[model samples]
Target: MPLNKQFNKDVCRNLFAKDSRRLFLKRTLNSATITLAVSSGLLLPIQAIAAWNEVAFAATNLQTAIKSVLGTDLSRASDKISIKIPDIIENGAIVPVTVSSTLKEVSTITLFSEKNTAPLVAQFELDKDCIAFISTRIKMSQTSNVIAIVTARGNNYSARKKVKVTIGGCGD
Candidate 1:
Protein backbone atom coordinates (compact mmCIF):
# COMPACT_ATOMS: atom_id res chain seq x y z
CA MET A 1 0.00 0.00 0.00
CA PRO A 2 2.83 2.52 0.82
CA LEU A 3 4.56 1.89 -2.55
CA ASN A 4 1.32 2.49 -4.41
CA LYS A 5 0.74 5.86 -2.62
CA GLN A 6 4.32 7.00 -3.48
CA PHE A 7 3.82 6.08 -7.14
CA ASN A 8 0.56 8.05 -7.28
CA LYS A 9 2.25 11.18 -5.88
CA ASP A 10 5.12 10.92 -8.44
CA VAL A 11 2.62 10.70 -11.30
CA CYS A 12 0.78 13.81 -10.04
CA ARG A 13 4.05 15.81 -9.92
CA ASN A 14 4.96 14.78 -13.48
CA LEU A 15 1.51 15.83 -14.75
CA PHE A 16 1.74 19.33 -13.18
CA ALA A 17 5.29 19.89 -14.50
CA LYS A 18 4.08 20.15 -18.12
CA ASP A 19 1.45 22.74 -17.14
CA SER A 20 4.06 24.89 -15.32
CA ARG A 21 6.39 24.77 -18.36
CA ARG A 22 3.59 25.86 -20.65
CA LEU A 23 2.68 28.72 -18.32
CA PHE A 24 6.31 29.90 -18.24
CA LEU A 25 6.52 29.86 -22.03
CA LYS A 26 3.27 31.74 -22.36
CA ARG A 27 4.44 34.42 -19.91
CA THR A 28 7.74 34.80 -21.79
CA LEU A 29 5.94 35.23 -25.13
CA ASN A 30 3.57 37.83 -23.70
CA SER A 31 6.50 39.79 -22.26
CA ALA A 32 8.31 39.71 -25.61
CA THR A 33 5.21 40.94 -27.44
CA ILE A 34 4.83 43.90 -25.08
CA THR A 35 8.53 44.78 -25.40
CA LEU A 36 8.30 44.81 -29.18
CA ALA A 37 5.20 46.97 -29.10
CA VAL A 38 6.83 49.56 -26.86
CA SER A 39 10.09 49.56 -28.84
CA SER A 40 8.18 50.24 -32.07
CA GLY A 41 6.30 53.20 -30.47
CA LEU A 42 2.89 51.64 -31.14
CA LEU A 43 1.64 52.14 -27.60
CA LEU A 44 0.82 55.81 -28.28
CA PRO A 45 -2.24 56.40 -30.41
CA ILE A 46 -0.98 59.74 -31.81
CA GLN A 47 2.27 59.67 -33.80
CA ALA A 48 2.72 63.42 -33.80
CA ILE A 49 3.33 63.58 -30.05
CA ALA A 50 6.42 61.46 -30.48
CA ALA A 51 7.68 63.51 -33.41
CA TRP A 52 9.66 66.45 -31.95
CA ASN A 53 11.81 69.09 -33.63
CA GLU A 54 15.01 68.88 -31.66
CA VAL A 55 16.77 71.74 -33.40
CA ALA A 56 14.01 74.25 -32.71
CA PHE A 57 13.51 73.25 -29.11
CA ALA A 58 17.18 72.95 -28.30
CA ALA A 59 18.22 76.31 -29.73
CA THR A 60 19.64 78.60 -27.03
CA ASN A 61 18.83 81.93 -28.69
CA LEU A 62 15.83 83.55 -30.34
CA GLN A 63 17.28 83.84 -33.85
CA THR A 64 18.56 80.27 -34.05
CA ALA A 65 15.29 78.84 -32.84
CA ILE A 66 13.35 80.98 -35.32
CA LYS A 67 15.57 79.90 -38.18
CA SER A 68 15.27 76.28 -37.16
CA VAL A 69 11.49 76.45 -36.97
CA LEU A 70 10.75 78.82 -39.86
CA GLY A 71 13.69 77.92 -42.19
CA THR A 72 14.50 81.61 -42.57
CA ASP A 73 15.45 84.57 -40.36
CA LEU A 74 14.01 87.30 -42.52
CA SER A 75 10.54 88.33 -41.39
CA ARG A 76 8.80 91.56 -42.22
CA ALA A 77 7.25 93.48 -39.32
CA SER A 78 3.56 93.65 -40.00
CA ASP A 79 0.80 95.86 -38.66
CA LYS A 80 -1.83 93.30 -39.64
CA ILE A 81 -0.57 90.95 -36.92
CA SER A 82 -1.91 92.02 -33.53
CA ILE A 83 -0.26 91.01 -30.26
CA LYS A 84 -2.26 91.46 -27.07
CA ILE A 85 -0.22 91.10 -23.90
CA PRO A 86 0.24 93.07 -20.73
CA ASP A 87 3.06 95.59 -20.77
CA ILE A 88 3.84 94.75 -17.14
CA ILE A 89 3.33 91.47 -15.25
CA GLU A 90 3.70 91.01 -11.50
CA ASN A 91 4.46 87.30 -11.82
CA GLY A 92 6.42 86.03 -14.77
CA ALA A 93 5.07 82.51 -14.32
CA ILE A 94 1.78 83.13 -16.10
CA VAL A 95 1.83 85.74 -18.85
CA PRO A 96 -1.16 85.76 -21.15
CA VAL A 97 -0.57 86.49 -24.81
CA THR A 98 -2.91 86.57 -27.76
CA VAL A 99 -1.84 86.69 -31.38
CA SER A 100 -4.24 87.36 -34.21
CA SER A 101 -3.62 87.89 -37.90
CA THR A 102 -5.67 89.74 -40.47
CA LEU A 103 -3.45 88.40 -43.22
CA LYS A 104 -5.02 85.93 -45.63
CA GLU A 105 -3.94 82.31 -45.83
CA VAL A 106 -2.18 82.18 -42.50
CA SER A 107 -0.33 78.91 -42.01
CA THR A 108 1.47 79.14 -38.70
CA ILE A 109 2.00 81.32 -35.59
CA THR A 110 5.09 81.06 -33.43
CA LEU A 111 5.95 82.90 -30.20
CA PHE A 112 9.32 83.66 -28.67
CA SER A 113 10.96 85.58 -25.83
CA GLU A 114 14.19 87.28 -26.73
CA LYS A 115 15.83 86.90 -23.32
CA ASN A 116 14.60 83.47 -22.32
CA THR A 117 17.03 80.57 -22.02
CA ALA A 118 15.39 78.87 -24.96
CA PRO A 119 13.59 81.52 -26.97
CA LEU A 120 11.18 79.47 -29.05
CA VAL A 121 8.14 79.30 -26.80
CA ALA A 122 5.13 77.89 -28.68
CA GLN A 123 3.93 77.32 -32.23
CA PHE A 124 0.48 76.82 -33.71
CA GLU A 125 -0.08 75.16 -37.08
CA LEU A 126 -3.22 76.21 -38.87
CA ASP A 127 -4.97 75.12 -42.03
CA LYS A 128 -7.25 76.93 -44.45
CA ASP A 129 -10.36 76.01 -42.52
CA CYS A 130 -9.15 77.44 -39.23
CA ILE A 131 -8.81 81.04 -38.06
CA ALA A 132 -5.40 82.65 -37.74
CA PHE A 133 -5.42 83.24 -34.00
CA ILE A 134 -3.67 81.72 -30.99
CA SER A 135 -3.88 82.54 -27.30
CA THR A 136 -1.78 80.98 -24.58
CA ARG A 137 0.13 81.62 -21.39
CA ILE A 138 3.91 81.54 -21.45
CA LYS A 139 6.59 82.00 -18.82
CA MET A 140 9.18 84.74 -18.99
CA SER A 141 12.54 84.47 -17.31
CA GLN A 142 12.85 88.19 -16.91
CA THR A 143 11.95 91.48 -18.54
CA SER A 144 12.28 90.63 -22.21
CA ASN A 145 10.87 91.32 -25.62
CA VAL A 146 8.09 88.95 -26.68
CA ILE A 147 7.88 88.32 -30.40
CA ALA A 148 5.15 86.77 -32.47
CA ILE A 149 5.81 85.54 -36.01
CA VAL A 150 3.01 84.73 -38.38
CA THR A 151 3.49 82.83 -41.61
CA ALA A 152 0.99 83.35 -44.37
CA ARG A 153 1.19 82.51 -48.06
CA GLY A 154 4.96 81.83 -47.90
CA ASN A 155 5.62 85.18 -46.24
CA ASN A 156 6.54 85.74 -42.60
CA TYR A 157 5.11 88.61 -40.59
CA SER A 158 6.25 89.59 -37.10
CA ALA A 159 5.26 91.77 -34.13
CA ARG A 160 7.13 92.41 -30.90
CA LYS A 161 6.18 93.74 -27.47
CA LYS A 162 8.36 94.47 -24.48
CA VAL A 163 7.19 93.06 -21.14
CA LYS A 164 8.35 94.01 -17.66
CA VAL A 165 8.34 91.18 -15.15
CA THR A 166 8.58 91.91 -11.43
CA ILE A 167 9.25 88.30 -10.49
CA GLY A 168 11.43 86.10 -12.66
CA GLY A 169 9.85 82.86 -13.89
CA CYS A 170 13.18 81.02 -14.07
CA GLY A 171 13.65 81.04 -10.27
CA ASP A 172 16.06 83.96 -10.35
Candidate 2:
Protein backbone atom coordinates (compact mmCIF):
# COMPACT_ATOMS: atom_id res chain seq x y z
CA MET A 1 0.00 0.00 0.00
CA PRO A 2 2.75 2.48 1.06
CA LEU A 3 6.36 2.66 -0.20
CA ASN A 4 8.57 0.32 1.91
CA LYS A 5 11.58 2.26 3.19
CA GLN A 6 13.47 -1.06 3.66
CA PHE A 7 13.07 -2.07 -0.02
CA ASN A 8 15.66 -4.93 0.01
CA LYS A 9 14.24 -6.75 3.06
CA ASP A 10 10.61 -6.35 1.95
CA VAL A 11 11.31 -7.65 -1.56
CA CYS A 12 13.49 -10.54 -0.31
CA ARG A 13 10.88 -11.70 2.24
CA ASN A 14 8.17 -11.81 -0.40
CA LEU A 15 10.49 -13.64 -2.83
CA PHE A 16 11.20 -16.38 -0.24
CA ALA A 17 7.57 -16.71 0.92
CA LYS A 18 5.78 -20.04 0.50
CA ASP A 19 4.30 -20.50 -2.94
CA SER A 20 0.47 -20.62 -3.21
CA ARG A 21 -1.75 -22.16 -5.96
CA ARG A 22 -3.24 -18.79 -6.81
CA LEU A 23 0.16 -17.18 -7.15
CA PHE A 24 1.31 -19.95 -9.50
CA LEU A 25 -1.80 -19.58 -11.67
CA LYS A 26 -1.45 -15.79 -11.70
CA ARG A 27 2.22 -16.06 -12.71
CA THR A 28 1.38 -18.51 -15.50
CA LEU A 29 -1.40 -16.31 -16.81
CA ASN A 30 0.85 -13.24 -16.73
CA SER A 31 3.51 -15.09 -18.76
CA ALA A 32 0.93 -16.20 -21.34
CA THR A 33 -0.39 -12.66 -21.67
CA ILE A 34 3.09 -11.28 -22.13
CA THR A 35 3.85 -13.91 -24.77
CA LEU A 36 0.66 -13.10 -26.68
CA ALA A 37 1.33 -9.38 -26.44
CA VAL A 38 4.90 -9.78 -27.69
CA SER A 39 3.98 -12.07 -30.59
CA SER A 40 1.08 -9.93 -31.82
CA GLY A 41 3.24 -6.83 -31.58
CA LEU A 42 5.92 -8.57 -33.66
CA LEU A 43 3.55 -10.01 -36.28
CA LEU A 44 1.86 -6.69 -37.02
CA PRO A 45 5.02 -4.98 -38.28
CA ILE A 46 6.07 -7.99 -40.43
CA GLN A 47 2.65 -8.13 -42.09
CA ALA A 48 2.57 -4.36 -42.64
CA ILE A 49 5.72 -4.41 -44.76
CA ALA A 50 5.25 -4.52 -48.55
CA ALA A 51 7.35 -6.49 -51.07
CA TRP A 52 9.02 -5.38 -54.35
CA ASN A 53 8.81 -6.39 -58.04
CA GLU A 54 11.70 -5.05 -60.16
CA VAL A 55 15.37 -6.00 -60.67
CA ALA A 56 17.93 -5.12 -63.37
CA PHE A 57 21.53 -5.95 -64.37
CA ALA A 58 24.26 -6.20 -67.08
CA ALA A 59 27.24 -8.50 -67.71
CA THR A 60 30.24 -9.56 -69.87
CA ASN A 61 30.53 -12.99 -68.24
CA LEU A 62 28.32 -15.15 -66.08
CA GLN A 63 30.32 -14.43 -62.90
CA THR A 64 30.16 -10.67 -63.34
CA ALA A 65 26.51 -10.87 -64.37
CA ILE A 66 25.90 -12.21 -60.88
CA LYS A 67 27.90 -9.33 -59.38
CA SER A 68 26.26 -6.75 -61.64
CA VAL A 69 22.79 -7.95 -60.68
CA LEU A 70 23.31 -9.26 -57.12
CA GLY A 71 26.13 -6.91 -56.10
CA THR A 72 28.29 -9.87 -55.02
CA ASP A 73 29.92 -13.05 -56.17
CA LEU A 74 27.76 -16.18 -56.09
CA SER A 75 28.46 -19.42 -54.26
CA ARG A 76 27.86 -22.86 -55.67
CA ALA A 77 26.17 -23.72 -52.39
CA SER A 78 24.54 -21.70 -49.58
CA ASP A 79 23.19 -18.88 -51.71
CA LYS A 80 19.62 -17.49 -51.61
CA ILE A 81 19.00 -18.60 -55.22
CA SER A 82 18.59 -22.03 -56.77
CA ILE A 83 19.53 -23.30 -60.28
CA LYS A 84 17.99 -26.41 -61.85
CA ILE A 85 19.92 -28.02 -64.73
CA PRO A 86 21.36 -31.34 -65.66
CA ASP A 87 24.87 -31.85 -64.25
CA ILE A 88 25.86 -33.56 -67.50
CA ILE A 89 24.23 -32.04 -70.53
CA GLU A 90 24.51 -33.81 -73.86
CA ASN A 91 22.85 -31.18 -76.05
CA GLY A 92 24.05 -27.65 -75.56
CA ALA A 93 21.35 -26.22 -77.82
CA ILE A 94 18.48 -26.83 -75.44
CA VAL A 95 19.70 -26.97 -71.88
CA PRO A 96 16.79 -26.36 -69.52
CA VAL A 97 17.18 -24.23 -66.39
CA THR A 98 15.04 -22.76 -63.67
CA VAL A 99 15.97 -19.94 -61.31
CA SER A 100 13.97 -19.36 -58.16
CA SER A 101 14.82 -17.18 -55.21
CA THR A 102 13.78 -17.24 -51.56
CA LEU A 103 14.92 -13.67 -50.89
CA LYS A 104 12.08 -11.31 -50.00
CA GLU A 105 10.85 -8.52 -52.29
CA VAL A 106 12.24 -10.30 -55.32
CA SER A 107 11.54 -8.33 -58.50
CA THR A 108 13.46 -10.05 -61.30
CA ILE A 109 15.25 -13.21 -62.35
CA THR A 110 17.96 -13.32 -65.06
CA LEU A 111 20.04 -16.13 -66.51
CA PHE A 112 23.61 -16.22 -67.84
CA SER A 113 25.54 -19.10 -69.31
CA GLU A 114 29.18 -18.07 -69.69
CA LYS A 115 29.94 -20.25 -72.68
CA ASN A 116 27.48 -18.48 -74.95
CA THR A 117 28.71 -15.72 -77.27
CA ALA A 118 26.28 -13.47 -75.45
CA PRO A 119 26.60 -14.39 -71.83
CA LEU A 120 23.19 -12.99 -70.94
CA VAL A 121 20.88 -15.80 -71.91
CA ALA A 122 17.62 -14.33 -70.71
CA GLN A 123 16.16 -11.43 -68.74
CA PHE A 124 12.76 -11.26 -67.10
CA GLU A 125 10.94 -8.31 -65.56
CA LEU A 126 8.23 -9.41 -63.18
CA ASP A 127 4.98 -7.62 -62.46
CA LYS A 128 4.32 -6.58 -58.86
CA ASP A 129 1.77 -9.37 -58.56
CA CYS A 130 4.26 -11.89 -59.99
CA ILE A 131 6.71 -14.13 -58.21
CA ALA A 132 10.52 -14.05 -58.65
CA PHE A 133 10.83 -17.25 -60.59
CA ILE A 134 11.46 -18.37 -64.21
CA SER A 135 12.54 -21.30 -66.35
CA THR A 136 13.78 -21.49 -69.93
CA ARG A 137 15.97 -23.37 -72.36
CA ILE A 138 19.35 -21.78 -73.10
CA LYS A 139 22.14 -22.52 -75.52
CA MET A 140 25.47 -23.38 -73.93
CA SER A 141 28.30 -23.96 -76.37
CA GLN A 142 30.36 -25.84 -73.82
CA THR A 143 30.96 -26.31 -70.11
CA SER A 144 29.87 -23.16 -68.39
CA ASN A 145 28.42 -21.52 -65.33
CA VAL A 146 24.68 -20.78 -65.20
CA ILE A 147 24.16 -17.84 -62.94
CA ALA A 148 20.83 -16.77 -61.45
CA ILE A 149 20.58 -13.16 -60.42
CA VAL A 150 17.74 -12.07 -58.14
CA THR A 151 16.91 -8.51 -57.17
CA ALA A 152 15.11 -7.95 -53.86
CA ARG A 153 14.40 -4.95 -51.65
CA GLY A 154 16.51 -2.78 -53.94
CA ASN A 155 19.51 -5.09 -53.49
CA ASN A 156 20.94 -7.86 -55.64
CA TYR A 157 21.60 -11.49 -54.65
CA SER A 158 22.85 -14.25 -56.92
CA ALA A 159 23.74 -17.94 -57.23
CA ARG A 160 25.56 -20.04 -59.86
CA LYS A 161 26.06 -23.65 -60.90
CA LYS A 162 28.29 -25.25 -63.54
CA VAL A 163 27.09 -27.60 -66.26
CA LYS A 164 29.22 -29.82 -68.48
CA VAL A 165 28.37 -29.87 -72.15
CA THR A 166 29.88 -32.85 -73.92
CA ILE A 167 29.31 -31.48 -77.44
CA GLY A 168 29.63 -27.93 -78.69
CA GLY A 169 26.43 -26.26 -79.83
CA CYS A 170 28.02 -23.13 -81.23
CA GLY A 171 29.78 -25.16 -83.95
CA ASP A 172 33.08 -24.68 -82.09
Candidate 3:
Protein backbone atom coordinates (compact mmCIF):
# COMPACT_ATOMS: atom_id res chain seq x y z
CA MET A 1 0.00 0.00 0.00
CA PRO A 2 1.13 3.59 -0.61
CA LEU A 3 2.38 5.49 2.48
CA ASN A 4 -0.52 8.00 2.34
CA LYS A 5 -3.14 5.24 2.11
CA GLN A 6 -1.50 3.28 4.93
CA PHE A 7 -1.41 6.42 7.13
CA ASN A 8 -5.10 7.18 6.43
CA LYS A 9 -6.10 3.60 7.29
CA ASP A 10 -4.16 3.70 10.58
CA VAL A 11 -5.67 7.06 11.54
CA CYS A 12 -9.21 5.78 10.80
CA ARG A 13 -8.65 2.68 12.94
CA ASN A 14 -7.33 4.80 15.85
CA LEU A 15 -10.29 7.17 15.59
CA PHE A 16 -12.79 4.29 15.69
CA ALA A 17 -11.00 2.64 18.62
CA LYS A 18 -11.04 5.89 20.62
CA ASP A 19 -14.76 6.41 19.85
CA SER A 20 -15.60 2.87 21.00
CA ARG A 21 -13.66 3.35 24.22
CA ARG A 22 -15.42 6.67 24.93
CA LEU A 23 -18.80 5.13 24.26
CA PHE A 24 -18.03 2.17 26.53
CA LEU A 25 -16.97 4.49 29.37
CA LYS A 26 -20.08 6.64 29.03
CA ARG A 27 -22.44 3.65 29.08
CA THR A 28 -20.66 2.04 32.00
CA LEU A 29 -20.74 5.27 34.08
CA ASN A 30 -24.45 5.79 33.33
CA SER A 31 -25.30 2.23 34.35
CA ALA A 32 -23.27 2.55 37.55
CA THR A 33 -24.96 5.83 38.52
CA ILE A 34 -28.40 4.34 37.91
CA THR A 35 -27.52 1.25 39.92
CA LEU A 36 -26.30 3.38 42.82
CA ALA A 37 -29.46 5.45 42.77
CA VAL A 38 -31.69 2.38 42.71
CA SER A 39 -29.78 0.53 45.40
CA SER A 40 -29.72 3.60 47.68
CA GLY A 41 -33.51 4.15 47.22
CA LEU A 42 -32.87 7.57 45.66
CA LEU A 43 -34.93 6.59 42.59
CA LEU A 44 -38.39 6.30 44.03
CA PRO A 45 -41.74 6.08 42.27
CA ILE A 46 -43.21 9.48 41.40
CA GLN A 47 -45.62 10.67 44.08
CA ALA A 48 -48.01 13.53 43.47
CA ILE A 49 -47.07 16.62 45.45
CA ALA A 50 -50.48 18.16 44.96
CA ALA A 51 -53.66 16.37 45.99
CA TRP A 52 -56.68 16.26 43.68
CA ASN A 53 -60.08 17.23 45.05
CA GLU A 54 -62.22 14.39 43.72
CA VAL A 55 -65.45 15.58 45.35
CA ALA A 56 -65.28 19.04 43.80
CA PHE A 57 -64.61 17.80 40.28
CA ALA A 58 -67.24 15.05 40.50
CA ALA A 59 -70.05 17.33 41.69
CA THR A 60 -72.89 17.46 39.15
CA ASN A 61 -74.75 20.56 40.35
CA LEU A 62 -73.33 24.07 40.29
CA GLN A 63 -74.04 24.74 43.94
CA THR A 64 -72.51 21.42 45.03
CA ALA A 65 -69.48 21.96 42.89
CA ILE A 66 -68.91 25.48 44.17
CA LYS A 67 -69.42 24.43 47.79
CA SER A 68 -67.00 21.55 47.47
CA VAL A 69 -64.31 23.53 45.70
CA LEU A 70 -64.51 26.78 47.68
CA GLY A 71 -65.67 25.36 51.01
CA THR A 72 -68.80 27.49 50.66
CA ASP A 73 -71.46 28.26 48.08
CA LEU A 74 -71.17 32.05 48.45
CA SER A 75 -68.73 34.34 46.67
CA ARG A 76 -68.73 38.12 46.53
CA ALA A 77 -69.02 39.79 43.14
CA SER A 78 -65.91 41.76 42.26
CA ASP A 79 -65.22 44.20 39.42
CA LYS A 80 -61.51 43.53 39.86
CA ILE A 81 -61.92 40.22 38.06
CA SER A 82 -62.61 40.29 34.31
CA ILE A 83 -63.98 37.44 32.22
CA LYS A 84 -63.46 37.60 28.47
CA ILE A 85 -65.76 35.25 26.58
CA PRO A 86 -67.94 35.62 23.50
CA ASP A 87 -71.54 36.62 24.18
CA ILE A 88 -72.50 34.17 21.47
CA ILE A 89 -70.52 30.99 20.68
CA GLU A 90 -71.01 28.99 17.48
CA ASN A 91 -69.54 25.80 18.95
CA GLY A 92 -70.06 24.65 22.52
CA ALA A 93 -67.27 22.09 22.48
CA ILE A 94 -64.50 24.67 22.33
CA VAL A 95 -65.57 27.95 23.87
CA PRO A 96 -62.70 30.38 24.42
CA VAL A 97 -62.58 31.77 27.94
CA THR A 98 -60.14 34.09 29.64
CA VAL A 99 -60.17 35.05 33.32
CA SER A 100 -57.95 37.75 34.74
CA SER A 101 -57.90 39.39 38.12
CA THR A 102 -56.53 42.68 39.36
CA LEU A 103 -57.03 41.44 42.91
CA LYS A 104 -53.89 40.94 45.00
CA GLU A 105 -52.63 37.57 46.18
CA VAL A 106 -54.74 35.58 43.77
CA SER A 107 -54.15 31.94 44.55
CA THR A 108 -56.67 30.09 42.45
CA ILE A 109 -59.09 30.58 39.58
CA THR A 110 -61.97 28.18 39.01
CA LEU A 111 -64.39 28.06 36.09
CA PHE A 112 -67.94 26.68 36.01
CA SER A 113 -70.37 26.07 33.18
CA GLU A 114 -73.77 26.43 34.84
CA LYS A 115 -75.63 24.05 32.52
CA ASN A 116 -73.01 21.33 32.06
CA THR A 117 -73.61 17.86 33.57
CA ALA A 118 -70.60 18.53 35.75
CA PRO A 119 -70.64 22.23 36.47
CA LEU A 120 -66.92 22.41 37.20
CA VAL A 121 -65.00 23.05 33.99
CA ALA A 122 -61.46 23.79 35.17
CA GLN A 123 -59.44 25.02 38.13
CA PHE A 124 -56.02 26.64 38.16
CA GLU A 125 -53.60 27.11 41.05
CA LEU A 126 -51.42 30.17 40.90
CA ASP A 127 -48.07 30.65 42.56
CA LYS A 128 -47.23 33.68 44.70
CA ASP A 129 -45.12 35.14 41.93
CA CYS A 130 -47.48 34.17 39.11
CA ILE A 131 -49.73 36.63 37.34
CA ALA A 132 -53.40 36.43 38.30
CA PHE A 133 -54.35 35.83 34.69
CA ILE A 134 -55.46 32.68 32.90
CA SER A 135 -56.72 32.09 29.37
CA THR A 136 -58.25 28.78 28.42
CA ARG A 137 -61.06 26.98 26.55
CA ILE A 138 -64.07 25.47 28.28
CA LYS A 139 -67.06 23.40 27.18
CA MET A 140 -70.60 24.63 27.58
CA SER A 141 -73.56 22.26 27.51
CA GLN A 142 -76.03 24.98 26.60
CA THR A 143 -76.68 28.68 26.71
CA SER A 144 -75.79 29.49 30.31
CA ASN A 145 -73.78 31.72 32.56
CA VAL A 146 -70.02 31.13 32.63
CA ILE A 147 -68.90 31.84 36.19
CA ALA A 148 -65.34 32.55 37.27
CA ILE A 149 -64.36 32.40 40.93
CA VAL A 150 -61.04 33.86 41.98
CA THR A 151 -59.49 33.11 45.30
CA ALA A 152 -57.39 35.97 46.66
CA ARG A 153 -56.09 36.62 50.15
CA GLY A 154 -58.16 33.70 51.46
CA ASN A 155 -61.36 35.23 50.10
CA ASN A 156 -63.36 34.30 47.04
CA TYR A 157 -64.41 36.86 44.43
CA SER A 158 -66.61 36.05 41.46
CA ALA A 159 -67.68 37.26 38.01
CA ARG A 160 -70.09 35.79 35.46
CA LYS A 161 -71.06 36.34 31.83
CA LYS A 162 -73.98 34.92 29.89
CA VAL A 163 -72.81 32.89 26.90
CA LYS A 164 -75.21 31.75 24.19
CA VAL A 165 -74.15 28.49 22.59
CA THR A 166 -75.67 27.57 19.24
CA ILE A 167 -74.44 23.98 19.47
CA GLY A 168 -74.04 22.12 22.75
CA GLY A 169 -70.52 20.97 23.62
CA CYS A 170 -71.66 18.47 26.24
CA GLY A 171 -73.86 15.59 25.04
CA ASP A 172 -77.55 16.30 25.44
Query: Number of the top candidate by TM-score?
Result: 1
For residues 1-172, what per-residue lDDT tens digits would candidate 3 score against the true structure? 6999999999999999999999999999999999898777777444325577899889999999999999998899999999999899999999999999899999999999998989998899999999999999988989999999999989999999999999998875
Q: lDDT for each of the candidates?
A: 0.92, 0.73, 0.93
- RMSD over all Cα atoms, model 2: 17.9
Best-fitting candidate, scored by lDDT: 3
TM match of model 1 to true structure: 0.76
Backbone-clash count (model 1): 0
In order of listing, the candidates' clash counts read 0, 2, 0
Question: Candidate 3, after superposition: displacement of residue 11 in Å?
Answer: 53
Q: Could you estimate the TM-score for every candidate?
A: 0.76, 0.56, 0.72
Question: Order of candidates by TM-score, top first?
Answer: 1, 3, 2
| Candidate 3 least-lDDT 10 residues | 41-50
Residue pairs with backbone overlap in model 2 = 54-107, 70-156
Which lDDT tens digits does candidate 2 get at residues 23-52? 888999998987797787954565567433
